[model samples]
Target: MPDTPTPLIWLAGATGLVGRALLTELGHEQPVLALLRRPDPSLPAQQQQQQQTALVDYAQPASFAALPAPSQVFIALGSTIAQAGSQAAFRAVDFDAVLTVARAARQAGARRCAVVSALGADPRSSVFYNRVKGEAEAALVALGFERLVIARPSLLDGERASLGQPARRGEQWALRLMRPIAGLIPAAWRPIRPERVARAMRLALAQEWAAVQVLESAELQTVGD
Candidate 1:
């Protein structure tokens, strides 16, 4: 690998809220290769011309060949089991897709892999969501990357496209009530901006750390703050 000041990065889920925020934070700092599930002509217009976009069908492992070799890989991949409508579909995106990318990055000689996970991710949890996240974290840990960072955030403070939904409304209300008393809340349970998470992810790759660092919400907020 070239001993360049800024390393090349491969970013998955570049269209998601956090992913897009990461791209913004990464702008002009390093060369970025953004991967999307399908070719979107509009994406080029939305992103800086210097950034490279690759169309990949993550469901098909063979499509990974379309991606360029990168020094680091950032995964912001996620899915709600509710939206997936099935447990299997949820795991497919949250776990399977990430593993595929991790394997590809390892093969491409990436120095590090950083991913955004959620809070309460325990593979042993009876709750399906946390179980999947925990399983994914375990899988990534086993990959033995030279540097691996997993960010687990709580009650992400971000806007949903659909604001009228009951869940969004409830979340907004809870955040409003908590924002005033955020200092009183435990570090692990405070709400954090998605942008903060994105910034932390970028820093994880840019900075040096001990092997297999798991960034709890407290650590993530500290970096983001």
Candidate 2:
């Protein structure tokens, strides 16, 4: 919209920890077309220089047509089942909404898409969360992007509490305890930082790639480093 000649990047769900980190990682190298449900008035002036914010309506396919034709798309959109309040609600965001956006991305001529998923994803998984994530990945692969990168991270280390998403009472405490012992765990299952995940997403998009690639938590550490 700013009439910049730089290649475009369309980003969704940029309020998340990984998304926030990606914003910094993108820096002033390229312009990012940030898709937001509403404008963020708190955006820093420097960030405003590099990002062009667009108001998005999730249900309106027409809005997708107005977005810059991106060479790549990054989707960090996700939600907890508890926060969604029901499995159906969770699927709407994690699966249905994601699929919708992917379709739009494909139509927008984006050659590559990098999305955040979780470990242990399987379409046939009995676990609702894993099943939903898997379904999303499967759907995206079926969309036939020139390159599709799925980043599956384990427990993400971040200052979520600062955002009012305080650690819950159960496994969250265990994750905090395990964070120190991450080296003792399997690389694929180890906890990783949101920054690392963000870095991995950017790196994956920059490669001369075709077909699909899935990055486990362990692989993210090296790429991010």
- Residue pairs in steric clash, candidate 1? none
- Of the candidates shown, which would achieve the greatest TM-score relative to the real structure? 2
Model 2 vs. true fold: TM: 0.90
Q: Model 2, range 7-74, lDDT digits (tens) per residue?
A: 78888877677777777776555888878777766555688877888887767777788777887888
What local distance difference test score does each model get?
0.83, 0.82
Query: Which of the numbered candidates is closest to the native, going by highest lDDT?
Result: 1
Error of 2 at 173 (Å): 1.4
Each model's backbone clash number:
0, 0
Per-residue alpha-carbon lDDT of model 1 for 1-225, expressed as tens digits? Answer: 867555678889877767877777776577898888876454436566768888787788888875678888899888787667799999999999999988888888887999988899999999989999999999998888889999999987776553221255567788889989988999899988888898887787667778788889999898845
